[model samples]
Target: MSDPKLLLIDAHALIHRSYHAIERDLTSPSGEPTKAVYGFASTLLKVIKEQQPQYVIATFDAGKSFRAEQFAAYKANRPATPDDLKSQFARCQEFCRVLDIPVFALAGYEADDLIGTLSKQAEEKNLDTLILTGDRDTLQLVDAKTQVLMIMGSTGELKLYDDAAVRERFGFAPEQLIDFKALRGDASDNIPGIAGVGDKTATKLLQEFGSVEKIYHNLASVEGKVGEKIQAARAQVELNKQLVTIDRAAPVTLDVNAARFGEYERAPAVELLRELGFQSLLARLPGDGDGDAADLAAHAPQDIESKYAAVLSETDLAALVKRIKKNKAFV
Candidate 1:
C-alpha cells in the first residue's frame, strides 16, 4: 500500500500557540524571543515523529495577502505582531529550512485558502491526509480520508476530527460550517452575526435548514422577526457564507505529493535544528530510528536509488532567503 500523503500545517498558528504557551520564560541566548521558535520547532519535531507521512508542506500567511480585498474586515482585530513575535517568524523559517521542509504561500490568499486548496487536492488524488491548523474554521474541510488535527489548548493534546468527529464537535457535518458561521457571524473577523441569533439559534436553524440559501428559501416558517431578518439580509448572509466556506474547488497549483518526506536527509535536519537551539527536536527526525514514524512513514528518500549521500544545493538556500526577504519585509 502507498504511504499516506499529508499536506498543510498552520506554521504561524503553531508558532503563536507556542509563543503564548511558554510566554513567561522562553528567551534566546542574545536576549531575544525564543518561546515561539522553541515551541514551533518542538511541535514540528513531534508532528514529524507522529505523522511521518510520505509528503509534507508547511504553509504561512503572506503579508497582507487577502485581508483588504476579500472582506475589508478580515482578521481585523489582530494587533500588529510585536517586534518580538516578528523576529521569531524568521527563526521559524530557518527551522523549516534546516529540516528541508517546503513552505508555500501566494499574494492573494490566506493560509486557510492554501490549506483548503491543498487538502482538496490531496483528497482528489485519493491520499489519506492530515491537516494541522489551530484555526477551527478549517474543520469545514474534514472528510472520511481527510481529518483535521486541531490542537487542544497547550496540553500537547490534539483532537482528530474526521466526518463523524466533525459532526460530534460542531453538531453538524463539515458543510454546515458556512451556514453556522453566517448566522453566528465571526467576531474575530469583524463579521456581524444575525442581530439576535447566536450559536443556539444558528445550530438549530442550520440543523433544520441545511444551508443558508435553503434556510432563506424556506424562511416564512421561521419565528418572529427572524424570518423577516433572513428575508431582508439574504444577500449579506449568502455572502458571509461564501466568505466562510472553504473553497474546495480552488485551482490548487501545488503538487502536494511532490514535497515528499522520504527525500529529506535526516542528519542535516537534526544538525540544523540543534543549531537553532531546537534542543530535543533532532531526536525526532525520521530515519533508521525505532519509532512509530518508522512504521507508517518511509524513512529514507526513495528518489535516492543508490546508497549515496545527496549533494546539497546552495541555490535552494539563496532562493529561500529571497522568499523570506520578499514576504517578511523585515530587515
Candidate 2:
C-alpha cells in the first residue's frame, strides 16, 4: 500500500473562505448563524473523502501572531473579523471535536506556522502530508513529501501544488516563494517588500540570485530602478523574509495516533450535524455507507491531471438550497 497521508487543515483560512462563499444569512434551526460552520464542514468532508487521508489535523488562529509583533503593521490592512463570523469559529472547533480531529491553536503563532510544524514532524515519520488551505503562503512548504491543496475563492476550485507545480505557476522552486514575496510584497497581509518591485522583477531577481540575501550580496550586478528599489528597502526586505517564512519549529507536539482519521464516534457527529440543520450532509459523513454516500464518492476529483474539476453533486445542490435557500448564493 502507499504511505499513509496526513491532512493538515488551515481552519481559519477555510472558515474565512466559507464565510464569504456562502450567504451570511444561513443559520441553525434556532437562528444562530452557521454559514461559516456549514461551509467549513462541507469543505472538510469533501477533502477527507477525496484524499482518503489516514490522519487529519486542523489548525486555527488563537490570537495575535509573532509576525504582528515583529512588524506592527503586519496584516494591519485587513478589517476586523465580523461579529457573526467570530462566533462561528467555536462552532467549527466543535465540529472538529465531534469528528475526533485534533485542533491546534497557538496564541502567538498563526495556523500556517502550526501546519508547517506539523508537516515537518509528519515528514520525519516518513509520512506524506497534504495541506489544505486558501492561503498561497503555504506554498513555500511544498516539497516531494508535502503538497498543498489550494482552494480558489473565486471559483471554489481545488488545485494541488507539488514542487513541480509550484515552479510551473511561480517560475521558481517552492522554497524560493518567501524571497519572491519579500521582493514583491503581499498587500493582503500588509507585508511591504521592496517598493516598486512587482512580480516580473521579483521573479527575475530570485531566478538569477536565488534569494534575498544573495540578491543584496550581488547588488552591484543588479542595475536600474529595480536595483535602487532593492538597495533602498534592504531592511524592509529582510523583515519581510522573516514575516513570510513559516515557522516549522512552533511549540506544538504531534501525537500521530491522536490524529488518526476514521476513529471518531459517528453518533455524536451525526447528532451535531442534525443540530446544526445540516440534514443534507448527514449521509456524507465518513463510514456512513448510506444512499447518498455512494453518490458522494463518485463526485471526488479522480486524479491530479487537471488542476481543477467540479466536485459538487446533486446532494450538494440540495444541501445548498436547504442551507442558503437561494441557488444564487453558491454561484
Candidate 3:
C-alpha cells in the first residue's frame, strides 16, 4: 500500500452498540443471535469502502487482565451481556475469520488501550489512524494524526472526531477528556467520581483549571462549594485519572503495517452473512454482482515495538499489583 491510512475498529463497542441498536431479537437462518453479526458486518463494509483504509484491524477484549486486580470496581456497573448476546461473540469472531480481517486481543488491557497503542505507532509511520468506537472515552486518542469515528446513529452515521471536534464538544482539549472523566468519574465503568459532579459541571471545571493535577495544585483559585467539593474528593480524582487514561504505551507484541485486510471480499463474506440472517447488513456490504465474496482484501501481521515499556515493564508492574479481593473480578 503506497498511501498510509489505517482504520481501527473497536470490536466490542461495535458489538455492544449493534446488540442494542438493532434491538430486534434476530436469529440466523440457523437460529443464532445475529443482530450483532449483522451490525458488525454492515459497519465493516462501510468502513472499508468509505474510509478506503490501506490497512485495517479490529481489537477485542482478551477477558483476562490486571486492571481488575488494581481496582475491583472497574466496569462493575455494566450489566452482564445478555445470555443472547453473550452467545453471539464467537459467531462474530467466525464472521471476522470468514472476512480475513486480522482480529487482535491482549492480556491486562481493554480494547481501547490496544487501539491507542496501534494509533500511536501508526502516527509514527506517517499513517493517518482512524479509531472506530462507540465509546466516548476513546476520544482521548483524537489528535492531528488520528481520527475517532464514533458510531453516532442506528442506521449508519459516524461522528468523525479530531482534536478540534473534541475540544468543541467538551470545552476541554481532546487530551483533557481523560482529566474531565477522571474528576467526574464514569458510572458506565462503575467509577464513582466526586459525589455531585456531572458532565456540565465537569466540563466547566476542567475548562478553568485544565487537568486533575492542576485543579489540585490550584484548588484555592476556585470558588464556591464546587471548590470545597473538589478538594474533598482530591484523592478519588487522582484514582479516576489512573483508571480513565488508556495506557497508550502498553507493550504490544504486534505491528500495524503488518495488519491484514484481505478477507473483506464479496463471496464467502456474503455466504456467512446469509447464514447469519444479516440481510439488511448484507444489502449494505461490498457486493460481487453475485455476492458471497469477502469484500476485505489485505493480509498479514506486523511487529510492534514495546509501547508500554516505560510505564508497565515487569520491574514496574508490581507497583500496581494487588490481590483480587473478590471472585467477580474474573466473572
Candidate 4:
C-alpha cells in the first residue's frame, strides 16, 4: 500500500567508518586483513534487516574526482588510505556482488554524485529513497521523496533526516547547507570558504540572506567585519559552492527493477562469508521464505544483537569472540 523504498548506500563512507570503528586487526584464515570487510558486512546486514528496502544500490568512489582537478588542494588534507584498508575495498565489492546488489562508480566523480543522480532518478520513478551514509555532504539531497539515514561514527547509531529534520537542525532548508558550508568551509575535506567566517556567522548570514549568490548581491546591506570577510572571499565562496554541492547530473544510469532486493544466490553468499571468516553473519542471510520484500517487511524490526542471539548458538558467539580477540594491530 505504501510507496516502495529504495536504499542507496555510500560504500566509501561506510568502509572508511568501518575501518576506523573496528579497532581490531581482523584477518581471514590465510592472513589477509578483513576488519573493514567485517564491519561493513555487519553494518550492511543490520540496515537490510531493519529497513527491508524493496530495492538497493551501492555507490563507490572510482578515483580522483573532477573537484580535485578544478582545485588542486581539494581533500589534500586527508591522509593516504592505509594499505590494509585499501585491500579490503575490493572485498567489500565482492560482498556486494555475492548479494546481487548493483554498485556504481565513476572515475571522474565521488560516490555522493552517483547517489545524487540515482536518488533523483528514483524520485522521478515515483519511488521513495533513503540514502545511507556516514557523510553529512549527502544531507543536501534530503527532500519530500528522499531522506538521509546518517550513521554516527563508532557508535553505529543511525539518524534519519527528512525535510523537517534538516530544517530543524540547520535552521534553514537542506539545500542551504551548501551555502552554509560555502561560508564556513569544511576542514575535513580541506575546503576553505571565507577567510574569517565561522559556523555562527555563516548560520546567521544564511538565515538572513538565503544563499551565497544572494549574500553577494546584498553585500552592501551586510555590514561589519563579517561582511568584509565575505566580500574578500567572494571568488573562494563561489568555488566552495561548487565543491560542496552534490552533482545530481552524474553520468550514471539506474535501472530500478534490476536493483530489487532478496533475489541473490544464497549459496554463494554463505560460502563467501565462510571464506572471509564471517561465521556469525552466515545466520543473518535470507532464507527461502525471504524471497519477497513484502515478507521481509511483514516481520517486526529487530536489532543486530537480538537477530544474532535468536539465530546463533552459544558456541557461535564464543567463536566470534575468539576471532575478534585474535587480532592485535589496530586498523
lDDT of 2 by residue, 169-221 (tens): 98999999999998878899998767677889899988999999999899999
lDDT agreement of model 2 with the native: 0.90
Candidate 4 lDDT, 144-251, residue by residue in tens:
999999998698899999999999998999999999998888999999867778788889888898999999999999999978888888898999999999999998
TM-score each candidate: 0.81, 0.87, 0.81, 0.86
User: Model 1 compared with the native: what TM-score?
Assistant: 0.81
Query: Best candidate per lDDT, number?
Result: 2
**What are the per-model numbers of colliding residue pairs?**
1, 0, 23, 0
Per-residue lDDT, model 4, residue 43, is 87
TM-score of 3: 0.81
Q: Across residues 255-296, which tens digit of lDDT does each residue of candidate 1 receive?
A: 754677756666566555545555455456666545434432
- Which wins on TM-score, candidate 1 or candidate 2? 2
Q: How well does model 1 score by local distance difference test?
A: 0.74
Which residue runs does candidate 1 get wrong by more than 4 Å? 1-3, 249-252, 288-331
Residue 69, candidate 4: Cα error in Å is 1.4
Task: Give the winner by TM-score: 3 or 4.
Answer: 4
Q: Lowest summed lDDT over 10 consecutive residues: which window, candidate 4?
A: 289-298
**Cα displacement (Å) at residue 279, model 1:** 2.2
